[model samples]
Target: LLGDVKAAGTEVREEYRWTQERWDEYRRLAEEMEEAEPSAKGLIFLDYGKQTLTSDGRILNEYRFAGKVLTQDTKWWGTRAWYIDEGINRIDVLYARSISPDGTVHEYSPDDITFSEPTRGEVFFGQGTAMSLTIPAVDIGSIVEYGYIDEEYAPEDPELFQPRFFFQSGEPAKLSKCEFEVPAGRELFYETFLLDANDPYIGQTIKELPKFVGTPEPVITRTDSSTIYTWELRDVEPLIWESNSMGYTTIAPSVHAGLYPDYSYYHERFGRLHREHIKITPEIDSLARAIVGDLESEKEKIAEIYHWVQRNIRYISVKGALASRFGGHYAQITLDNKYGDCSDKAILFSALLEVVGIRSYPIIVMTNDAGFMDRSRFPFWGGNHAINEVWWDGERHVLDATGNLHRFPTYSMGDCDLYYANYVRGEIVYNPPIPAENNSMQSVTLVELRADGSAIISDSMWFTGDMEAGYRGYFEYMPEQRHEMIVEQFVSQRKAGGRLSDFALANIRDISKPFLMEFSYEVDDYTIEAGNYLLLEVPALRYSFPEIELSDPNFGKKSDMTFMRTHDVTFTLADNYTVRFVPERFELSNEYFDYVANYEVDGNTIRFTDRYRVKKLRIPISDYAEYKADAEKIMAYVKERIFLSEE
Candidate 1:
């Protein structure tokens, strides 16, 4: 019963068949018990999963779920489990059994399982189907157990395998164990992560399991014979969601097992596979030429191509078998369809670059989970995202085609300064860091105070790099009416009861240039009037400074903070008013940041300028106090007011 239920490229035997009548009967029984009363504090008794790898390169995975439906709210847990895939032929739900509180037991054969195609949203273009069935005779205190097996050949490298086991779950477990069995004489390699070396229960069959040292580096082990690796955790507590916890994979105890000889094999294999699909077709060449028509500079040409891809190609997630996930479709197909996932878009862009004689390579990256990569853990399945890197102007530029709103030559903030897989080189590479100056915002404001206690202000703001990317993304996705509302809100927030007029945005669609926005507004009662005297307060050009308190317990000790800004303002008072008070020039500098502010008055005009920048993007936890102190200093300087009086 434990052997291969069905082999690859082999017919299923008659003994494994289940008739349609049996399925209908099980469905009827489930429906009859749909109204079962609820239980208190739904709890799971056991949850187990297992996987076996055969010498023939086929993976068989199995799972067993045993839980009690304590209450109506928790009925969904024990009702059903689904094994869904577009490649349904490779999936099989063996059987299900349920024992009621009164000791009556009911069993469901394979034929009792129901198969149906579920509806998917447009965003999921080519997702497959689902095979699902409800457990029979389930009620309060009932024990429901069901298991299924799935077999699939790894698309990229059949011999390469990645196995992960979580030692914790949302529900407390009495026992949890993950076991891996490989055919004898097959090369086996693995690394354990986030496990306590001091734990006495941890066991391994290999003699060369690296000693658990101080740091939590991956412990690598290799064996030639058929190997069995088991990781077990007893009396585990429920994993509670913390406010700002790192990724689950980072904190969870698990093992990554692979059969590949080295990282080089993965890189070479995937590089070759991906290159085969990146054909430079005639259509691609023509499109590239059209996009870069008569553009002399390489930067300009790249900008044009990058912009075109962002504007034209749509993003749709199509997850299925390994082939569809790893061996993405050709670039031409993506162009024709006008939609593709990250890999599809990356491949298409790479092909387009090739057409223009520009050298580029596809890079595997993790968008939000960069911590998953460990230098010691060399596996091909490192990254969940794929992007392209372009070589231009003697420098490398990372491009993410799915970033529809990002400006050319500047990638989204998450895409910058991260480690990615250089499959061609068979190693990991850290992307070049963007300077704080490149990711900056500058604003200029002119204010004219009237005798009527009202004022007219004209302001212009410019954004570059990641700051530009944010505004550009807003303009791209926001409708015209909503954009106007946002502008109005922006003006009102600075000056209460302010009205905006002549609002204009520049370089919103021009990806190669910085983003600009200019607006004129009038605020009522801008000055406080007291019996033949007026008091005017010059508003701060920038009101908020990023704050990261070192004392905050929830603050991630490993995280870093970065910020940069510049502002200049001029206030022209009416002839009746005179400058009464002005903040003196102020300067503050620390290891983490620098700030400079100057205020000047000449006749009826007051001028002020300020600049603040974070010296480093990554501040160690030990330096958090210094960074926080610098930020506070900058905030205090900006909040200082300049006063005007009527003569």
Candidate 2:
């Protein structure tokens, strides 16, 4: 085929630019190969990138580890297969350490295959870069299993993982190149499928490998003419289930088990060094003074600094291998360079705030990577983000410097709180924004019907600290895309029973000082059939706790838990209305607890009121079940109460 193509086409033809008809033929052949055989078990291959031994030989071997599995009975392979080209010029050293349920480490050789050899062999077309990865297995696990594949990827390598042969990098690839063998007694059902790659170079590609019964099997194939350095893999499932997936899960509505910092020597050193060397210069002082002039409120001053950094800095995600080198140090250089990741922006904001009278702490937050932050282990190697915590007027405010356009009133709390394990490092650690200080508030829909068959309703909300920070992140950072996302989210949640006729945001206001967000939207043309009325439930609308509780079954009682969120809403009925379901006013009255809910009606407007406070800093997991149940109960009450009537 290579000779035929070369002879048929002009020698001047570009590399990889095959004719359309020829490309289609190649794809067809690849498809046939893909539909090969059934390999029963799962196989993971490790090809750790190259390593150079130093003169002193200071353990460079331990430095280039790739992929961390969080499950049991995981089998991996390598052998000479780790060599990319088999020419001996480019080779990878593979090593693996599996952890037992009891935390015992077992090292394995490359030749071992504990389970059935599911997918094996690489197809070299006698020449070139085109290739494919195949996985053949049987239906055995749940769809929700957490599977992740992180290969040794470095962008500096020119030929590193470029998209070819119908694969688009970064996007989801749908390839059916393998067959699933159904065991005699086992059932077959696949609920969900997911493919993800953080690197942008490799195009996402998916080809279906047909499943045929008996001896005929499937294969994954690819043909590339270019010889480039990169890493690629096809993962079909997670190493462990979500329940056992380690790290921080959610952040906004304050959860107890946020991501804990890993207790590694490097982490401890980074924490200590960060805490020690975090500093601001006098030049920042002059700059801040010039900008603020005479802002009286500490909040305003802090907000100005936050806005300045966010506005001045641009977001550039340092991904892949370079992140490890670019992440630490160079905060000021990033500021000077005017481009940085989230942490760099945060550092600049903290520095600027320090220049003024307002004190700020440089906090580390866990992004999706590195799992959750473990507070119990204070110095856990946790978190992949850097944010700021500003203290003002006896209260601490969370500041995210990434989105400068969203300073003050427009705060963002979206996924920022999902797995927030934050700590104040350096001289500014006086009172960093703790999980306890976060709060979210939202009003529920209290729709009352009138005699004329029209409905009346109202809504209100408030947020503080981390919740405000989240809102700020969303409102300010992503102004262009915010309203659209908000509309979609609202429509999806509220328009469950009735078809969404329309939604419109009204009464827009920016109250940055107290950091409050207020907006109203109308859901029009909503109808409930007689005897089967419409019930619009209020989503748990806090940054964290209002939606779900941070408690566990093993831990019976709630922690020194903090409750913080407040809301108000009114619904105006059309006419001749009557109350159908009215929630009972409830209050939890323990020093450690802070909560209240009530409803009232005046004229045509029905008002729903709520309040919450935080008194404790930490909540134990032992009491999570009760807390979760209580939260559900409250949510049910709020959802159940709906004013109904007929014309």
lDDT of 1: 0.65
The runs of at least 3 residues in candidate 1 whose Cα sits more than 4 Å from the true structure, single-residue gaps closed, are 1-49, 63-83, 88-121, 130-157, 169-174, 196-226, 237-240, 317-324, 369-372, 375-377, 479-482, 527-563, 575-598, 601-604, 612-640, 643-647
The candidate that achieves the highest lDDT relative to the unseen native structure: 1
Residue 385 deviation, candidate 2, in Å? 2.8
lDDT of each: 0.65, 0.40
Evaluate model 2: give its TM-score: 0.50
Candidate 2 regions exceeding 4 Å error are: 1-57, 60-91, 94-285, 317-332, 357-383, 388-400, 403-438, 444-449, 456-567, 572-575, 589-595, 601-605, 611-621, 642-647
For candidate 1, write residues 450-485 as lDDT tens digits: 876689999989876668878877886788778788
Q: Model 1 RMSD to the real structure? A: 8.5
Q: Residue by residue across 1-647, what tens digits does model 2's lDDT show?
A: 22221232222224322234533443443243334312223222222222212222111111122222212322221111221221212212222233332333343322221212224234112211221211122122201111112222222321111111111111111221222222133222211111222211111111121121211111322223211212233322212212212222211001011012233433444445444334565665577787677898887787666667766777765432322222334456655667666766666666677677777765655542333333332333345566666678887666677654453633443224233433443222222223433554444554544454443333334455555545555655556556666745654565443323334442233434445433333344344545646443333434234323322222112122243666655566665555566567877644345568887766656676777665543233433445566656555555463545554
Clashing pairs in 1: 39-70, 39-71, 86-128, 184-226, 185-226
